[model samples]
Target: MGHLFSNYYEAVSVILFGIGFTTLLLNRNMIKKIMGFNIMDTAIYLFLAAKGYIFNRKVPIVTGEVPTPEQYINPIPAGLVLTGIVVSVSVTAVMLSLTIRLYRRYHTLDIDEITRLVKEEK
Candidate 1:
């Protein structure tokens, strides 16, 4: 549709989210799952950034004379995006560390294998 084309960023983000969600569901490898999660996070960031942007608006900064609210884009989405990036990085770091520990102990990255090994150990 014409509206879909006009908002290409949202469309791309939706497509990326679907790919990431599929990957997350289908992949058994822990690393691949983490990568898929990161992809989903990136898609969210892109969607937020795109939605926050205006065609001909400036950043919400006071440079000279005071301007009306219409002259600048909303800052909340940008702030949310930045916060999301920090949280994503923290989560990724934790996930990677856990994966490394699992690989070291079980000598495998397949989640099903790990679950089986844990069950066998019990």
Candidate 2:
């Protein structure tokens, strides 16, 4: 019970990931799909960062005094997550721009409608 309470973030992240997957799988709106993708990306980032974290740890840096590995938290996972967030933002921006273009052309954000219109045009 205590461990479960302590690791609630993991549980929330899993729920978010599942919701995002469901949205991605079932949603018809392009914007909603993008939002779902963002949710999934965020959940993954949260889960990874949470996994990498340690209780009662300091930042990873060597001081004048000799430091043991256990004294500091590993920086790699945090760095990776930061990079992932940047990439996700860029991807989201590009996806939104594409969605905007699609909406302008078809006057609808529905993926099915867009496909059908494209099919009719071809």
Best by lDDT: 1
Top candidate when judged by TM-score against the true structure: 1
Give stretches of model 2 more than 4 Å off. Answer: 1-6, 61-66
Q: Tens-digit lDDT track for model 1 on 25-108?
A: 889999999999999999999999999999899998888897899999988999999999999999999999999999999999
| Each prediction's whole-model lDDT (CA) | 0.95, 0.92
Q: Which ten residues in a row have the lowest lDDT in candidate 1?
A: 17-26
How well is each residue in 4-99 modelled by candidate 2, as lDDT tens digits? 788998988999999998888899999999999999999999998888888899888787998889888778889999999999999999999999
What is the TM-score (0 to 1) of candidate 1? 0.91
Model 2: per-residue Cα lDDT at residue 12: 87
Q: Please, what's the RMSD in Å of model 1?
A: 1.4
lDDT of 2 at 91: 97
* Per-model root-mean-square deviation over C-alphas: 1.4, 2.1
